[model samples]
Target chain A: MKLVPTIRYNVQDIITKTIPVYYGVFTLIFLTLFSMSKLTSLYMAGSFSGASFNSTVLIVVIGFVYTRSSFRYLTQMGVSKRTQITGKVISILLISAVAVVMDRLLELFAEFLFKSTEMTYEGSGIAFSLFDAYLSKLGPVAREMTLIGLGYTSRVMLLSATVFIAMLYVRMNTAAKVIVSVGIPVLAFVGMPALAMLIPEQMAKLIHTIAEITGLSNGLPIRSILWMTGGTVIFMMLYSLITRRAPIKD
Target chain B: MSSLELIGISKSFGNVKALDDINLTFEEGKIYGLLGRNGAGKTTMLKIIYEMLFPNSGAVHMDGHAIGGNDTALGKMFFIGEKNYFPEEMKVEKAFRLMNDFRKDFDPAYANRLADAFGLNIKKKIKSLSTGYASIFKNILALASNAPFILLDEPVLGLDANHRDMFYKFMIEKYSESPFTAIISTHLIEEVADVVEHVVIIRNGCIIRDEPRESLLDSGYSVSGKADTVRAFVSGREVLGTDALGGFETAYVLGECPKNDLPEGLEISRMDLQRLFIQLTNS
Candidate 1:
């Protein structure tokens, strides 16, 4: 529908602005890590480390920037807020997919240049630094790409949606904005820990339930992806609510 | 010939009412002058029509469909707003490329021609342009858009007299070749005095005056004479304001001239758009 053009415009805008910042931050961190690794390897034998950026930072940055100015630009172009919300989420999905690929390439390059990084497993059987771990077990190539892409996409979109909503929530003058801003820190700093202490093994039980539902220990990413997809939809609905009558700031 | 109607439109920010119960219709192909003083809800009205700011109540319609969420309908009108909404780093020509993506009827050749006329360098980034050139850049976009409706808010914000004259002439030329509804909001009332066919003046969040240029001009007449004679002549009529000095006074009267023999030393003159605006909007 109208989302097609909006997506094209937003994706272009997001990538044009986002990529440069992403690469700039990544290069600074990577080169600093490389120099540190070089200096450390000289003194300490068997000390090895290679750095690659967590593309989530880029997604978060782009999300903040979109709310900061890009939405104003698109809205000026006659884009509806609904279309903008949808377009931005889709843009994040595309950016995340592309960023994941680029990130993996850079990780591989970093590993090649700096040190060795093998896909290792913890005792719980969760794979980290994934490399060819699921090629034989995860069915066809397309399905694997879908699983991986959707996983990256959902994570990135979650951050993008959260950051966007948080930025926009500040724009509201409602009491709810004040409540959310005040309540979250209280919950994190004082309430959660107290709740955890009051209920025996409460935090452990919660994490265990989440793990079981995600099939994390069972090594099935589909359940986690389905949950992430559900989360993404919920965030989109929230975005639609906040932005239905959102005013472009002066 | 797209018709735009704002029925009972109202907007506010916090406790301040920006526009209140405003209704207006922009018929096709006629230029309108939207005149208001600073913070008189002029920009707010324009922003509301463009859906940049949602109204607290009422609706905006173009040919009967709600324009708030309709991009295709919204696309039919291009607004040359006061502020820079485009990304700061984008070059002037790149902005045209972006505009091309949104507005289908944007004439790149015509835009380039206008840019050339203004001696604007298309390669310069928008942020690097001076205020006058920035205004020129936006004006070029709006003129070349060929949209059925074009809203210009302070379109000649920083242009010199020569450039402003050139803009007015070219605006008329563009309208002549391909007609469209243009609503220009500005403080420089006298500049667009003859260029616009209709006048809409807002004051303190209300539409105080909305009428045709000729009728509005004819609605008021200023009389200057001896202070006593002026006061006597304006005794029965609605006098907007009066200026008095050493046995002489000038009284601005509203609602048509009295058809009577003028007393000695009493004279009447037509009220220009600017004077009419000043009289009507004086608060």
Candidate 2:
């Protein structure tokens, strides 16, 4: 199908589009925070205990904003929903991969070039580690990359699916749009706690199954692939169901 | 040949019924003027055909198959909607290229030529263009699209007199050379009266009149003279509407004109499309 090449092109477009927006916003934010931290370090010991940019969150937010703003425009240009779904999935994956690479490079540059120490906080205890510690402990570079790549890929896949699902209601009336925009996050946040309380036994059973399937190092890859595939199907169905008869509006 | 058939199409927004039981057919290679009053479901109908909005209860058929998620059917029809659906940041030239990419039949060269004729700067961002220029930008794309069917809703909106004239001329010129179906929904009935080959007059949410332009023009006429004479002449005929100026009266009548020429000062003239539209849709 033409979807293959169309998706390839859309992925390039999404990647091309994100770098400028992400870098521009992140640069301004990072510079402002860096200045504030340096000034604070004058009096206190350490304000910047290695700034851990939650780049996974960053990728998700980027996906959300892009899909929200561009879906109508893209569809109007004759891009089918199937192509859109496939393209977005590929784009989100590529974007997450790019972010991981950039993040790692920044970490290495900060450590080797600037001699900065990275820190891990275990509850109240703080432990220092070099940039190389992750690679050394994870195993061979190729295996470590597979595990880490799967982790990021799964996060991007789930997030992109979620963003697409939320955006499906964008053409609905103002009330529906608002409910979707505000309601989803509230539900997601509250649902976690609510689900735990409502179905303790079932939740424990599900966790046990997940744990059994994903035995830490040995099963992480399978778990990652499962989440990625599961998220894609679930969100695609949700989006198609709601938008099956949606009236396109400004 | 190709045609678009709307079978029992109906749409409603809340309690407001935008379209009701609209079953219409738009055939190939002719200009169709869809004349309707404001809020008469013109835009809604056009949007449904292009898949921008789905009808509440019925389907749009292209050729023989019902359209559903099939871009190929819609790809044959290009919708020139009133709203600017293109990305605000996209350049005008970029929009043309994108349209070309979507439809292989879209002529980028012809688009640029149309842009030049309209004096539009294709390099300018879509949002940066003035309202008139924005309409021109979209018009250029539609003109160059070369799709088998094109639905234009208020195509000349925001256009000045000169641009409007130019557009009409270009539309006719293009049609003569290479014929394509055009369903034009516009309030400016007089402007498109001579251009459209067929006429579809909609009132409220119902089809009031559907005929060829020649049949429509020949079907109705006006008789003006003294009030008494005009009334006597129009009596027993289908009076669409009447206008009075002091003692002078003119009655717009439908079907046919009286051939008897015995009246001393009674004057008869063909009812223009604009006047016919006004009377037919005047509630």
Candidate 3:
């Protein structure tokens, strides 16, 4: 009944599950790169970083996996469906922020290591943060703040969408589940390409219009941030609707 | 004192009606045995009460307010069913800790004590536990929950005889120390016949019997003797059921045995809960 406690408990649960996965992936990536650097004499010439993108993917997966498990467990513990959603929403926001900050810190650390080793290595060891690679035109402070906003909004939007998909899967029957599972890839890989081929000019115009609307065509990501924030709100509302009366399945 | 009431509740899965229009009330502090045969809607009713499954035509209420997924009303009850709702990787000790964090009344000391008594390894992940230990893990939480109401669906499933006995004993001890309502849904009727103060028997999605345990037991008596003798003695009476092996027989008859009429070579004893349940739900 205590809303704060329920939200706190869910946030704790999500973080408990997320920490190990996040760190494990980071460790794996670091070990692989270290091994490659020594064994194959691999050298990166330009900005070699996808921390934001990788972290976004990981957070999306964490969202999907925890939705079913947490919903069932919390409901069994007498937490209401509404409370569960509220808890999840807060957790998604908190985790997105944490992931962004952690990724930035790791990038700084990587840059430090690369700079120190640059004199000894044969090739120039340079690393650029995601913000510097994409938003070079902005001032330092503006770039950092915009990147943080972009990270949170994008991660929240994608994770909320993933959570919604997970809830939908839980609600689906076997036949419907099969249909959607097969339908999505077919639509993405085969159907869309065929349609685009049938109407090349129209499809090209549509893609261009969409890119412009989402602010991907422009260098400044301010409009994209607004788009992503709107997306987060929409996806979270859908997620809440699906979860409100969701039954605990056997 | 509080009461949980179900008013005209019904549920269906496709064409198969799981529960019909039914009304039941569970008071604040009595142990109830929700006995039914397999697929008799006992679990369905419990799920509905706990808000795990919504009823199609009715609502569940605590005191006077409807608890249509209300947090405060739901917080008053805990339902431990056969399903393992905990994350697979969670250890038993962490689960107890989380329960403590979730419920104000949750008693961690009691949970740890129960876990030790059951010889459950608190360090092991839930997925690593056997079926019986898993049941023990959940039951321990329910016992230590200290909520106003606890619903146990097949609480003793997969439990060995010794563990089953331990669970029943622990349940009684907990109930006596600080009374709370417990609706135990199980097929093992005889085991809980003495433990449960109230008896509710459901048959084909309908409640056929609801009364005090003593009155239900007093409704009938079992007479055992030669098959023919028992049959003759039970003639013209309401015979719930009868079982025979070789020449010997046991017949369950409605109403009390006539103490004065001592039929030769015949013996009468108290009704067997399992036998009564079998007969009542035989249809």
- Runs of candidate 1 exceeding 4 Å displacement: A1-4, A13-52, A107-150, A166-170, A173-186, A198-203, A217-219
lDDT of 3 by residue, B200-239 (tens): 9998888899898989888989999999899999999999
TM-score for each model? 0.87, 0.84, 0.90
Who is ahead in DockQ, 1 or 2?
1
Q: How well is each residue in A185-209 modelled by candidate 3, as lDDT tens digits? A: 9999998899899999999999989
Against the unseen true structure, what C-alpha lDDT does each candidate score? Answer: 0.78, 0.73, 0.83
* Residue A109 of model 1, lDDT score: 53
Report the alpha-carbon TM-score of model 1 versus the true structure: 0.87
**What does each candidate score in C-alpha RMSD?**
4.0, 4.8, 3.8
Total residue pair clashes for candidate 1: 0
Model 2 reproduced share of reference interface contacts = 0.40
Output the lDDT of residue B189, model 1. 91
Distance from true position, residue A161, model 1, in Å? 2.5
- For residues B203-244, could you state the per-residue lDDT of candidate 2 as single tens digits? 777788889999998888988989999898877889999999
Where's the lowest-lDDT run of ten residues in candidate 3 chain B? B274-283
Between the candidate structures 1 and 3, which one is better when assessed by lDDT? Answer: 3
Per-residue lDDT of model 2, residues A1-250, tens digit only: 2354445544555567666565556555555545554555543223333334435556666656666545666556555555565665666667677766655544443334223222221110111221233333555676546545554655566665756655665656778788877888888888766887999999888877765564333444545556666766677566655655555676
In order, what fnat does every candidate score? 0.53, 0.40, 0.82
What CAPRI class is candidate 2? acceptable
